[model samples]
Target chain A: MEDNVKKIMHVMRRAPHGSIYTYEGLEMILIMAAYEQDLSIAFIGDGVYALKKNQDTEGISMKGFAKTFMALDGYDVEKLYVDRVSLEERGLTEDDLLVDVELLDSVEIGRRMTEQDVVIHH
Target chain B: MSHRFLATILNSDKVKIGILLKEGPYNHQAADTAYKFAEAAIKKGHTVDAVFLYNDGVINATNLTDPPQDDRNIADRWSKMAKEHGVEILACIAASKRRGITDDIMIDGGSITGLGTLTDIAIRNDRLLTFGD
Candidate 1:
């Protein structure tokens, strides 16, 4: 008999994506990893900015928390997904992002969310 | 022990829902939306075990919310509903203290807890829905 695996999904769908929300989402992912929980991230709407490259926080005097997205891969956080429609709406491409991500369509994203044992929306 | 195990198995069909409220009842629309969702979830036969109030949401737990004559007193309404339903309404201790929310009011099932409690709900619950702007 096989063991029941618990899968968790984090859905990011905020606009004007500020530091606090970004930090909270990343912290959740890290904490899940530390506990050996299965975790995945899905970026929707303006939430994609958290993974964008060349984020110049110098003007805002904000801490460089965007760099944490790059460190996600090192934390065994490989399931980074971006909504394809949202990416195109924002005029962004794979090259515009700091981390490599799997672009998913609406149907595929819904299917994935429904398949998870736990789903967290931020 | 077997009966308890059977009950657990039967309840497994129901989803464990944790609602994270980050905003206060100052906005009537947001409060109305949350209440409607909670009502709808009950109507749909899904169990809502807990509601974790964080950040500005600590304001909702305060006993001093007084809205205008024209607008609905959402905070009071939430408190009443929560009391009647026996719902677990946990206000984050760190957030509540920072926002000057003291333990004066008698909000049934609502208490000031820590972030660790929220993390426990996140891990144990089947769905952690966050309500933020």
Candidate 2:
């Protein structure tokens, strides 16, 4: 039963709603979580905006999926990480994020990335 | 137990590869790159299991895509690859609907599938490579 488990990482580098990459990436993560692979997500660059607080997409005519980040824990996707520089560069902090994530430097994040068998970057 | 490199280390010579394409044809080189990568992998004695299209990538499966006389027909290339190599070229149904791509316009050997199918491809294939932005 344990033979097929894979270490898959989803890397988010795009801003939310600007393009469909990050949004659709979230959808894929939600589904893969059910399969119980060793899944983790690293938010980098403008991808940190995806975890920001109080994102309302009413004007954009798109569904507010920022809240969806909070629901990922329910799907058993608890291993979430954020690039420290990316969050700080955007003038955001842990408090600005909608979810709890480990804020690590890109160096550390890259090390962990090397450990993943499949790394899907969005 | 799972190893660091799952398929390459455990499965001997031939690796089962699954591709996830996120961009469309003509506009970007993503579809072309994926096709070339799959072809190269197959030529090297690997099994190209599937090509799953998402977002704008679903446009690659549409038969309505007709290039000019001098240009390469990307959609036809995917069709031929699917037919000859037995690779499953699938587009996400939700994305296809948003892009006005219907089953009637789907290219030969291409089909519409759900995200669950993508999950299955990720699990079963030895290597799952994602292309595009």
Candidate 3:
């Protein structure tokens, strides 16, 4: 990786489906991944719910893109960090998530966020 | 002489900012806050490269918007601000297509473009600020 490659971090603080922020944030991430930047995603608060397994959106008539998280690695956007406190608060574990993610404490996530060139919260 | 040198340094430190708005007008305060922030940044001698409208924010660029006589016209405000500052007001093509926003229906200074354009804006600008619901 070049020194000029920006470290961009997208912070997902909302749950999926209730609002369009998380879904649209994913869309933005997918686009930015093509630029070959050092991109990472942080799942905090209700954002941890977005990666939950077996999301059935058929009854809600919304497109189920939960599986899309699994495809991010192919685009070279493999850094998915989850907030450990948030997951425990919601009674969710790594097994409950659809994709593999680095479970880090909030302090660690904050440190990484401070190191980013760009931080976008959704 | 020292004050003049400091002023030059301060002026040279001005950053290029790109704003990403993800909500529509009226329903949220994101558009208003973004507009004010853009205005303030420009007043502070910074360059606002562009305002990228995503998702429901495409409505901010539509020409068909007509607020009440007593209300502030959000689209017109964006158009006026863009014209005055030479700022590019771009709405995501995909988002516009879903929201019935076409080229003909866009405000004078606003245009519909692809997400690639947004990527370029983000990469080129020194700061990328996002405002949404």
Instruction: Give a tens-digit lDDT track for model 3, residues B1-133.
Output: 6999988888898999999999999999999999999999999989999999998999999988778999988899899988999999999998889889999998999999988888888788989999988
- Model 3 CA lDDT for position A64: 88
| Predicted candidate 1 versus true structure: per-residue lDDT over B76-132, tens digit per residue | 666766777656788877667767887786264568887667667777767777776
Q: By descending lDDT, how would the candidates be arranged? A: 3, 2, 1
Which candidate has the top score in DockQ? 3
Q: What local lDDT does model 3 show for residue A92?
A: 92
Worst 10 residues of 1 chain B by lDDT: B26-35
lDDT of each: 0.74, 0.90, 0.92
Report the TM-score of the second chain of model 1 against its true counterpart: 0.81
Error of 3 at B101 (Å): 1.1
The digit string of per-residue lDDT tens for model 2 on B41-91 reads 988989999999999999999998768989999999999999999999999
lDDT of 3 at A97: 96
Better of 1 and 2 by lDDT: 2
What local lDDT score does residue B43 receive in model 2, on the 0 to 100 scale? 89
Residue A42 deviation, candidate 2, in Å?
A: 0.7
TM-score per prediction, in order, is 0.74, 0.92, 0.94
The candidate that wins on TM-score is: 3
Write down the C-alpha DockQ for each prediction. Answer: 0.26, 0.56, 0.59
lDDT of 1: 0.74
